[model samples]
Target: MTTALLPWSKFLICALLIGLAGPVLTRSGDAIARLTGLSRSWIGLVLLATATSLPELFTGISAVAAAGAPNIAVGDALGSCVFNLLLLVLLDALSRDEPVYRRVDQGHILTAAFGIILIGFVGAFLLIGRGALDIRLGHVSIYTPFLILLYFVAMRAAFFYERRAGTIAFTGEKGTETGLAGAVGRYLAAASIVVGAGVWLPFAGLEIAEVMGWRASFVGTLFIAAATSLPELVVIVAALRLGAVDMAVANLLGSNLFDVLVIAIDDIAYTDGSLLASASPAHAGSAFAAVIMSGIVIVALLYRPGARFLGIIGWISLSLLVVYLLSSYAIYLLGH
Candidate 1:
C-alpha cells in the first residue's frame, strides 16, 4: 500500500518520518549519554550532531551518486552549519534564564571560534584553488590527509580543554527515573522511521526544487539544510522543557562545530579533488552567510548578559538570517 503512493506523496511522508525520528533519536542519545557517563556537550558534538546530520550525509551521497553534483553535497553540509547556528539564537530566546550564554561552558565558545577558523581555512583553500594553479594540479588538490589531521587536532584540543576546565555538564532529566528503558525502545523504533525518512526526503526535495525551477544549490542550502537540522530543533525544545538552558545553548553551538568538521569528512569522501571546483558562485554566498551567523553566535556567547539581552540577540540573528536568505535568493535570480 505504501509503495503505491505517488512520488510527491511519498516524499512528504518521508519528510514527516524524518521529522518524527529526530526527537526519538535525541532522547535516546540523552539516555545513552547518561548510561555511559558522557557529557551532554560531548554527546551534542559527537552523537547528536552525527545522528542529526545523517540526512545530509545520505542526501549528499545520493546527489553525488545520481547527478555527480558534488557542489550540491558540499553546499548542503555548510548550509546546515548556518541553520544550526541560527537554531542557537532560537534556543536562547526560548530559555527562561538571565543570559543563556553565561550558562554555557566557556569551552563551547573556544570550540566555536576554532570551528569558524577551520571553515575559513577551507573556504580560503577553495577560493585560492579556483583557476590556473588548480588546473596545473590536475584537479584541486585541497582534499589532503593533512586537513583531516588538523581537524582531529583541533577537536582533541577542544575536548581536552573542556574536560580540564571541569565545566562540562549534562542537563537533561534523569532517564532511569522516567522509565527510560522503555523510552530507549521507543527511541529505537522512531530512529528506524527517521532513517527511512532521511533516505527518501532528498529525492522528494530534489523533485520539489525541480518543479519550482530552483537550482540544486538552492535546494540544498535552504530546504535540505533546514530538514537535516530538525534534530537540533528538537534538542533545543527538549532542553527548554527541562530548563536545561545550558544544554540547549551547548547543543546549538556544538552542532555548528560538528557541521564545520563534517566538511573534513566530505572532503575525504570527495575523491574528485576540491569541492569548490564544481560548485557555482552561490556557495560562496552561503559560506559568507555561515560566517556572519557564526559571528553573531560568538558575540552572544561572549557577552553573556540577561535573558532579555539573549532574546534580543535571538531576534537580531533571526533578522540577519532572513536577510541572508533574501540575498541568496536575489543572487540566484540574478544568475538565472
Candidate 2:
C-alpha cells in the first residue's frame, strides 16, 4: 500500500513546485520578451507557449518510452489542447469588462482556426493511414518530418504576416529594461523550474494512480494534464490583471497549437505503428471531445456579438465538458 501511494505523494510535491514556478516563469518570460524586443504575440506564441508546454512534452515522451504506448502520448497532447481551450472559457467567465473574446483582434481567431485545422489534418492523416484512429508505426516516416518543417514555416509566416499586416504592434511595456545578465538569470531559472516540474510530475502521477487503483489514462488525461497546465492558468490570470486581454487570448490559443505540434513530435519518437494502441478508449473519447470543444471555442470567438452571449457559450462548453466527464466515468465504472 505504501508503495502504491508513493506516486501520489510525488505528484502532490510536483504540483506544488509547478504552482510556485508559475509566477516566476511568467515574470521571466515577460522579461525575456522585453530584452529581445519581441512582441507579446510572438512571445506568447513562441516563448511562453513553449515554456509552459515543456511539461506536456516531457510527460508525452516519457509515456512513449516507458509504456511503448504512443496512444497515451497522443491522448495527452490532444487532451492538453482541449484543456487549454477550456482555460479560455474560464478566462471569459472571469473577465469583468469586455469579454476577452471581444477585446482580442482577429489574429487570435485565425490562429485558433489554424490550430484546429492543423489537428484535423494530422488526425485525418492518422485515420487514413491505419483506416482507424490507431497510430501507424510508419505514419511518422512521412508525417513527423513534414510536420516539423511545416511548424517552422507556419511560425515564420505568422511573424511576417503580423509584421506586414500591422496586426500586432511591437511595443515594449513601460519601465521594462533589457538587461543581459538579468535576462540570462531569469531564463535559466525558469528553464530549470519547468524542466524539473516536467521530469517529476509524470512519475508522481504514475504513483498516485497505482495507489488509488486508477488507470494511467485517467491520471494522464485529468490529473497530470491539469497539473502541467499551470503555466497557462498563471499567464491568463496575470494577463487579466494587467488588462492585456489580447495577450491572454493569444497565450491560450498558442499553447493549444504547441500541444498539437507536440503530437507530431511524439509520433516521430515512437517506434510503433499506432500511437493509440495502448490508450483506453475512454481516453481517446476525451481527446475527441477536446478537439470538438476547441472547435466550439473558435466559433464562439468568431461570433462574438456580445459579452453576455459569449459568456453563455462558455457556460455551455463547461456544462458539456462536465457531462462528458460524468458520462465517461459512469461508462468506466460499468465496464470495470
The model with the greatest TM-score is 2
TM-score of candidate 1 against the unseen true structure:
0.81
| Stretches > 4 Å off in candidate 1 | 1-10, 97-99, 135-140, 167-193, 267-273, 307-323, 334-336
1-336: candidate 2 lDDT, tens digit per residue: 778656777787777776676666667666666666566666677777887788888777776766554544665676677677777767877776656567677766667766766666555554454444443446454556666676666677677867876644545443434474676577567757876877666666666766787766666766777888887888778767766676677777777777767776676666665453334444545545655666676676678645364445444446446745663464245211
- Per-model TM-score versus the true fold: 0.81, 0.83
lDDT of 1 at 134: 54
Tell me the tens digit of each residue's lDDT in model 1 across 263-286.
Answer: 555555555665555656556666
How large an RMSD does model 1 have?
A: 4.4
Q: Which 10-residue span in candidate 1 carries the lowest summed lDDT?
A: 135-144
Off by more than 4 A, model 2 = 1-4, 67-71, 125-128, 131-141, 167-181, 272-284, 307-336
CA displacement after TM-score superposition, residue 330 of candidate 1 (Å):
5.1
